[model samples]
Target: MRAIVHEEKEGLEGLKVKEMPERQISDNEVRVKVHTAGMNRRDLAVVTKRHKADDPALIPGSDASGIVETVGGNVTKFQPGDEVIVNPGLGWQENSDAPPEGFEIVGLPDHGTFAEYYTCTEDHLERKPEHLSFEEAGVLPLAALTAYRALFTRGNLEAGQTVMLPGIGSGVLTFCLKYAKAIGARVIVTSRSESKQKEALNLGADLAISTEEDWQEALASEQVDLLIETIGNATFNKSLGVVRKGGTIVTFGSTTEDEVTFNIRQFFYGQYNLLGSTMGSAEELREMLGFISDHKIKPQLDKIFTMDQYKEAFEYIQESKNFGKIAIKVR
Candidate 1:
């Protein structure tokens, strides 16, 4: 099978597509021929030093849409030729406040989807939403699940309330905007790119501001019930300034600086809730699929790249040029 492999010899260099041996499925596992694999920020971090590169040789991607080729003898939920999308977050089956001890992302120590063929336990596969194409569903799992958990589970986002997103370019933020709008929430977003700001407006954002402008002044009169922050130290302090008193702020990724310092007195004085979230649990992933199906929300696809253009695809994302999810055609 052809796969995107990262090695230590290159030590933080980009991934390259190469031949790899296919793994035989275990008794409870299923094998799928990947149709389209979704790329995320972490996928880029896997090949870079932003995240830990634990394995010298690894296939690094957590999202994919594919067709089941073969199932283990014990598997009962699915059979050959089934269209499915993978739930990239493993373990944490129950809807606890945090991921359990066994939780880990799909593509670190173990091989991930960015290949012609991929295999995982039957538990990881979910039937792809019928309304979505392989490319759309390929980008659905990780971003949608994370957004669901961040908005609903952690931030307690409700309809008729205002939700603010610090950055609008990534897949998770795009999903958050779609979900919030589907539920009738007023959405506000900030982006440095004029095109991204306009795109967010088309996607149902009530207000889109340029990050270069003063957020506190621009949104001072608006009531921010919930704020989702992903840019980390770069915008977290500014996010605090815009969120309403007693509002909730949910944070996931640290795309910028890792360490952040904010005034402690202002936090307690304002009675604000600062919640941290990562990927969703299995239960939330299930619910997110239903939500997508019910709302008919389609993924905002930025671009699709063929296997040969993997390098350009990686570079495109690393440069922060994508406005939505990036899909890799594995077929």
Candidate 2:
């Protein structure tokens, strides 16, 4: 099997395509012939040793769409030739480290779907949404699951609520916009680039405002019921400013700049609740996959690259040039 392996944590330069031994599936696991692999910031971080690089040699992809080429003897959910998408997160014996409530995630602190062949538990595989191509399905697990966890699970986003989403370029934000609009919520999005704002509008955002210079003034009179703060630190206060009193603020990642400091009094004074969200569970991923299939929701892809071109794909993501999810054709 050919795979892009991280030989060491020397950044992208250390990533090399090589022929590695095929992963042997255990009796409780199933093997997939990966068609497409989703690239994420965490994968880059792991490769560069910024996040987790415990293993010097590792395959660094978490989300993938593929065909089940073989199933373990005990597996009942899948079989050879089944079209599937992997929800990367599995359960743990320790309850505290377990996934919150209903969901689990893929691609972190575990072996992921970065190779031509990968193996996982039978339960983690879900039927790919019929409406999506393999390339599209590959990008859904991590991004869509995070959006579902943040908006529905933690933020308690309601149909009629006004939601403010900070930063609108990534697939996660786009998933939030599309799902929120589908449920009749008023979606408000902000981006530093006008071009990104236009892109957000095309995806059904009710209000797309440029945050080039404190554009919270655009919504000064209106208050949001929930806010999704991906770019924390720099925009946390502004995010707080736009939300109504008692509104929930769900935070996920701080992509722009980290090391955020804020006045704790603001939360007490405003009666705001700050909720921290990570990726979703495998069950949530299944639900999202079913929902998108039923609703015919499509994910926006910024670009696609083959396994050999993985370096260029990461370069595009690092440069922030792509509009949404960037994928790698692993097969």
Candidate 3:
């Protein structure tokens, strides 16, 4: 199989197209012929992170939508020719507050979907959303699952409330905007890009502002019941003042500074509930696919690159040029 391998070198220098022996499915696994694979920030992490690079030349991708070519005898959920998407987060089947001890994402230690063929455990596969194309569904799993868990499970968001999504261009934030609006919630978003702000409004966000604007001052009239914070140090403190009293703030990623300083007095005084979240559980992944089907919500696609163009795609994402997920088409 042709796979994009992440070699020992750091960053984009390590990415190369190579022939790798395709693994045959075990009795419990299904072999999928990957049509499209989506890129995440963690795909880059696989090459740069020391632990991941320690075992060089691993297939590094977490999101893919493909057709089941063969299913092992023990697999009953799918058949040959079934369209499926992978739940990048392995282990942790039940819906819970946190991932279980054995949990890990798809692309690091285990080989991932960045190949012509991918092997998926039966439990980690879900039928693709009917409303989406392979390109769209390919990017939906990771981002949509994270957004669903962060908003519904962790944040306990409800309709008739306002939810703030800082850094609107991310794939997860775009999913949050769509899901929140579908439930009749007022969605507010911020982005450094003017075009992204306008795009968020088109996507039914009630309010869209520049990240440069004062968070509290710009949203003075809005009472944010839930806040989804993705950008870390640069805007975390500013987002603090935007949420209403007793509001929930769920953070999944800290792209900027890992450690942030905030006023503990202000946090307690406002009765804020701060929570951390990661990728989601299997049940949540299924529910997220159903939600996308119900709302007819398609993932916001930024760019499409061919299998050979993997390096350019990685470079594009590294520069943060995409407003949504970037996919690499294999077929």
Candidate 4:
């Protein structure tokens, strides 16, 4: 099998496609022939050394869709030729207030899906939605699951409510907009690129604004019921200003920078809710797939790269050139 391997010596420069040994399955695991793999911001972090990996020859990818090629003795959920998508989050099986101890994401310590073949526990695989292509399903796992947990599970988002989504072009944020709109919610999005703002409007956003402009002033009269804050310090305080009193702010990532400072008095006086979330449970991933199938929602794919073009794919994402998910075709 050929896989994308990243080492500490050269960081991102060290990333390369190399022949590797095939994965072996355990009693409760299955081996999959990867068709397509999705790239995330975390992939970039790992390659850049911002996020450290315990393994020296780490295969860096979390989202993927493929066909089951073999199953272990105890694996009964799937068999050969069954199409499946990998659930990146390990542990945290059911709904809970928080993830259980020993929870970890795939693609770090464990080898990931960026290869010709990968293996995982049977419990971590789900049937791919019938409507989505391999490339679309590849990108849906991590981003869609994250958005589903942030918007519905933690934020308690409901139809007819207003949502403010900052950084509209990323995979998760784009999923948020589509999911919210499908549920009849009014969505307002912000992006630094004018073209992205325009694209958001076409994707069912009620309004789109420039992140560079005075967004608070533009939305002065509209009180957002739920604000999904992923930009961190750069937009956290401003998000507080646009949200309605007693509204909720659910944060998942700090793309700009972590450790934001906000007024303590304002937070208490306004009686607002501040919540933090990460990748969701396996149950949520299954539910998210059903929701996509039910609503007939398709993930927006920005570009597809061959396995050999992995470096160009990484560069495209690092430069923020994509409006949606970037996929790597493995087969």
Candidate 1 global lDDT: 0.90
Clashing pairs in 3: none
Off by over 4 Å in 1: 11-14, 50-55
lDDT of 4: 0.91
Clashing pairs in 4: none
Assess each prediction's global lDDT (C-alpha) against the native.
Answer: 0.90, 0.81, 0.89, 0.91
Residue 229 lDDT, candidate 2, scale 0-100: 93
Most accurate candidate by lDDT: 4
TM-score of each: 0.97, 0.92, 0.97, 0.97
- Model 1 over residues 1-331: C-alpha lDDT tens digits? 9998887544336467799999889989999999999999898877776344454578889999999999999999999999999999988787897899989998886889989998988988999999999999998899999999999989888889999987798999999999999999999999999999999998889999998789888987899999999998989899999888899899989989989999999999999999999898888999999999999999999999998888888989998999999999998
Deviation in Å, model 4, residue 204 alpha carbon: 0.7
Q: Once all C-alphas are superposed, what RMSD does model 3 give against the true structure?
A: 1.2
Order of models, best TM-score first? 4, 3, 1, 2
Q: Tell how far residue 29 is off in model 4, in angstroms.
A: 1.2
Tens digit of lDDT per residue, candidate 2, span 238-265? 8887789889999887886777777888
Stretches of candidate 4 above 4 Å error?
A: 50-55
Candidate 2 total steric clashes? 8
